[model samples]
Target: MPSEAPVQPPPPIKIGGHCFEWGQRSYVMGIVNATPDSFSGDGVLDPAAAADRAARMVEDGADLIDVGAESTRPDHQPLDAAGEWARLAPVLRALREAVSAPISIDTAKAYVAERAFDAGADALNDVHGLRADPALASLLAARELPAVLMHNQRGRPPVGDVIADVRAGLEESLAIAEAAGVRREMLILDPGFGFGIGPQQSLELVRRLGELRCLGRPLLLGSSRKSAIGWALGREQEPPSTRAAGSAATVALAIAAGADIVRVHDVREMADVALVTDAVLHGRRRGDPA
Candidate 1:
């Protein structure tokens, strides 16, 4: 036998020039933090520099680049739509010129999303999962763009276990999308790894990630240099750059458990991790026989 239970690829999502054939192999979404206060310490404030960084990530094996101007770190300062757009415009413009790969704008504001689309962004990644801004879903539906609706528990207390909490949060996001006329095939689900959960819950969330498959959408797991990795290493003070090995471990495990896309800062390493993990679980290579 080739392997154990294999991934059932969801309907392909075509963004820009790429079609994400989910189960063919794990996909990598490289993080391009444009904020000066980004938690990963890889944020580039200059538009030109950020674009160069994003292009390098693509050459290193990124399927998509998620660019964000706001810092999502806990208790980070908030940016209004105008403020956010100001930070994103130049970076997105440069990114459009620098890379042909799909660009995903990681923002929850309808205003920002609209401008981003005009600037050549191919998709939207709402960490609030359509819950923060009522108009965001409408924008997505109207634009007919692909989106990542993540289950975030930043302010609300969890409902139950990690799996249950994530499931419930994502369901509400799905409901919002459906009501807004967004196509189901254009959506992806992300179980927020470090947003509002503790270390144990985060670990358990990944362990049982497959259970969320019942939601009937592709899953995106992003634990790239998140605080949970530092917690897992028992050194909560460890810097983000020092957590690559732990992030790689989570990437491999998540892919085996049915993750379709992995968002990461260490693109080259995690890309290799996803490729090897896919080969192991799927039992095939680029040119290998069945």
Candidate 2:
């Protein structure tokens, strides 16, 4: 019989003075939606509420907190830079002062990211993956911050195979980042499960997620309470809040399939899910402790 190949470890990234040793265990990124229309039904309108959410997530074992002002839900009303900054700045300032965990600014605009960094955000998570704002990649490069580049589009046709399509799309994003001077080690790849893709394809991406390890960057999967999970649950008509169990299933499978980070809405529940998944998949079995 052939021997199984060893898993290649993902490079470490430091944010807010904490180092994330990828591949050591799956990390949980808690979501703090500063918008009023978050798909997860957990959005908070006030900075104090967002700050409170961040603090609780950190207490619930979240490795980091993702703070986003604009809602990314399908058909969400787009916000201009000023609007986004207006919603984001206060939350970033208060969260930075309250939570010791690293904060990630989820925005596609470079201007918002710049102000976020000024407000003490530790990293940038761009859903458009440099396709929306040309200045975004350069800004991240200049700041030397870790980046999460997600595959994204609007009404694009499939390339027959979903996983291959995701890879090809992300390749274009990688090129843009590299051309803008962002190093490969500073990049993390997200397959963009819900954005501009159908529900079945999103499930296929989760099922074939291990194939994305070929990209050689730490994979961050954000399938939390997405429409895909609702569809998979045979409850496509259900509200996003009802998809927690479905999200947990996907998170566990993602961890088993080589995902290094899982971004989720229900931080406490997903944190416990990741903990057990890590123990089962990454923990060593030896004699009982002395």
Candidate 3:
């Protein structure tokens, strides 16, 4: 008999009226940095400009918009709860009114998440994976919001093989999210690319991303315009703004490796990339044109 097809994970729970059906097609999450010191050089300090960017992302086919006030770049100065809230609140409020797509607050602080939720944000994109603040999980559970738990260990040296290292870290993160009353359906996993880990390790994780499916949750890949991509392209000495094409290449590879959503800075290009990739991987008909 022919081999049985792999069992796909259940559909993702709806967040802010968006149904993320895993394996149907990959989704795009656009990045909207609201800080003055974003590493990607795409920061929009003005609330109005931030809102406009969010709207444009939605128009560019972004399924979700992630707004971050504090930069997650390595060794970056951390923003306090009040400061982060001040930057995120206006953007979240404006995007809530300006765009129909779900708005994710990319913050590790519980206080900021609370305020963002109150300001109409729909999800929490925690880079610390609920480890930064004890109250973060409780808030996410209480609000019953969708979350992206990423594995980040700032300044930690690589311990073993890249995939094995990432897998172990994500397993711990998954346990924390589950223990905090966050349902499996409402949780997504990210294998922290470009965070603490080396640039080569980041590229290795993208190539070996399929292994993460053993956790049985949707996987989100956020390699857009990161320094690692630049390094892979021999542009480590250059700026991040030039990594768009490299980012697209990684996005396509991640999708083929079982990424459910790709968080990106250049939405228009990545959205188109996802469309063609989806058609090739999941939409190709046997008798269709070559």
Candidate 4:
């Protein structure tokens, strides 16, 4: 019998003042969509309510909070810069007062990212991988904030092999980031599940996620309540709230495959899921001292 390969631990990544020691523990990023049209259906209309939710997520063990003002679901209408800023400003301000965890702004617009960073967001998660606004790469570089460069092929057909295509695309994005003066330690790569992937491709990505760590950056998986789950469950038309179990499954699998961070909406439940998955993968029993 062949010997099993040794697991490769991800390198530590720092964003703002937080240090994420990947492979030691899985970090959790809670979602806070502040728009009415979020595909996840958890958007809060009130800024105070959003702030409260942020506090609850932190209490529930969220290592970070990702606040988004616009809907990025396929075919969703895009919000203007001013509109996005208006929706995110109050919530960002409120969250600043509520939690100490690093906050990330999910936006493709450079202007929106600038304002959010100015208003206290510690990171930027650009779904477009800085392609939507080339200037965003420069903005992230200038601000010296860590950014997630997700692989998104919005208008293309599924590539013949999902993982290969994702790796190629992310390599290009990394080149762009470097050209913009972003440091290698400041980059996080997301495979962009459901952004352009079909059901099979999404599943394969989760199953083979370890391959992505070869890129040498911390891996962030954001499969929470995504459409890919609905597709896999034969409920593509169902609401996001109904996909918790599937999301949990992905979270566990992602951790097993070497994901450093799991971004989720069901913070409390998924945090528990990450804890158990980490214990199993790393050979630590539950309640063992860290």
Candidate 5:
């Protein structure tokens, strides 16, 4: 099928002193996992080390840092609000003072989000898409901060095909956000890759990612170092750190498909990929004296 007709991007969203000019170029969201059991083996346990890592990512061209204390990988350790906050607090406080870029909290618990907001998190990256915690929407509405409400298929029965399921899930999450007075422009949509589907389905989601732009919000693609890439490369037993090449391939394709943000573990390398791909697809040259 032909790619969807291009639509004008919505107005820029300002969060934590960063202006996200959608459609001008793709943004890079560097991930900082504070858990001991991260799937990617890049988790940082010390608060200072995490802050240092975020500073390095920003230096390497990350637009924002996403901090998470819990591991979302398969069979990972389960974390409660108290446990998560324990690991996330010092890290968030350190990041607030360490880097100039905005910070996004990756969690679904309202209690954790509330405390994270107080501790200086600029945005929310709710993987559960408002389905796990009802209070999260109200908090976001009250804070009026930016958020990424992903179409999470985990533990939910599919309504239809991949795109259909993604659309349906996102629409439901949007409805929930709307009811709580969360502004439309403050929310970005993500198709929850590998959250519920297998490798092929995750790849299909990225291949047809352009179709989701009709949802009228910016899209965020986060297939970095995920198992789907390993499966695609026929190296299922390889470490996540070795998936950078596969990850870069998806980032390029997703950028061409109208992805506005790419959440990644390898910030410097993916930033280069985003820069070049953005140049080719959107004429976003690095040294243009615009």
Candidate 6:
């Protein structure tokens, strides 16, 4: 007789109007960069084009659509809240008219989040994990909206282990969210790939992602077209569009590692990768020996 496979956890909790079930099936959150300088070269200068791309992503199997105005790429100049809102507001409005998938605002500024939410964003993906603006947690708590708390290490770490560092940062952020009255179930944790981690550190986190799952919050892996992919593929000069296959590979790996949500640029391809990987890793076979 053969041994049984380990049982995966239940799907992610449905927050607001979104269901983020994990393990059962991987969910893809498509990226919609509303800026002209997006590293992925997918940003749409025209609001109509942005809306159309978002609608296409929804039809292409995206479970969510993440919209951002500023480029969070390394060395990119950050935009002010007003500037960011100016670029994002039109896209968000247009998307609301075009697609039904929940909209997530990728921002750190409370002002931007507030405006985006009012414009129909259902969730918040704070890269700074609420550390940049302490008031953002309160805002989320008040709105009862789901927020992804990504572990960021903008400063020097006291320890050398990236996993330990990330765990600590996430715990601290979760504590802050709790203190601010945010619902525990409304929180999601991300390992913060490429935010302040090097290529080796990022890989190690992906390998040890299961440890982060112990935190009990849904784990969101945003390794799509990230700098770490470029480093691993030995294509430092290549753009994000060139990293699609690499990103798809990571999406599959991340799903196997127990990631609840995958933030990705190439939604259609990554969604297919997630489905196939999930079938292999967790789906039941009809005639396999057990």
* Leading candidate by lDDT: 5
TM-score of 5: 0.97
Every candidate's lDDT: 0.90, 0.87, 0.86, 0.87, 0.91, 0.83
Provide the global lDDT of candidate 2 against the true structure.
0.87
By TM-score, highest first, what's the ranking?
5, 1, 2, 4, 3, 6
lDDT of 5 by residue, 119-189 (tens): 89999999989999999999999999999999878787876688999999999999999999999999999
Give me the displacement of residue 172 in model 2, in angstroms.
0.8
Better of 1 and 6 by TM-score: 1
Write the residue-wise lDDT of candidate 6 on 78-97 in tens digits: 88889989988988999988
Question: How well does candidate 4 match the true structure in TM-score terms?
Answer: 0.94
Question: In model 1, which runs have C-alpha deviations exceeding 4 angstroms?
Answer: 1-8, 287-289
Q: Write the per-residue lDDT of candidate 3 for residues 173-270, one digit (tens) a residue.
A: 77887788988788898999988888888988788888888888889999998989888898887888899999999999998888889999999999
Worst 10 residues of 3 by lDDT: 1-10
> How far does residue 179 in candidate 5 sit from its true spot (Å)?
0.4
After superposing candidate 2, which stretches have Cα over 4 Å from the reference? 1-6, 285-290
Relative to the true structure, candidate 6 reaches a TM of 0.92
- Residue 176, candidate 4: Cα error in Å is 0.5
Q: Residues 179-276, candidate 4, lDDT per residue (tens digit)?
A: 99999788899999887777788888888888887788888899999888998899989998999999999999888887889999999999999989
Query: Which parts of model 4 have CA positions greater than 4 angstroms off?
Result: 1-10, 285-290
**TM-score: the better of candidates 2 and 6:** 2
Please give each candidate's TM-score.
0.96, 0.95, 0.94, 0.94, 0.97, 0.92
Better-scoring candidate (TM-score), 4 or 6: 4
* Candidate 6 positional error at 266, Å: 0.9
Top TM-score: which candidate number? 5
- What lDDT is reached at residue 163 by model 2? 83
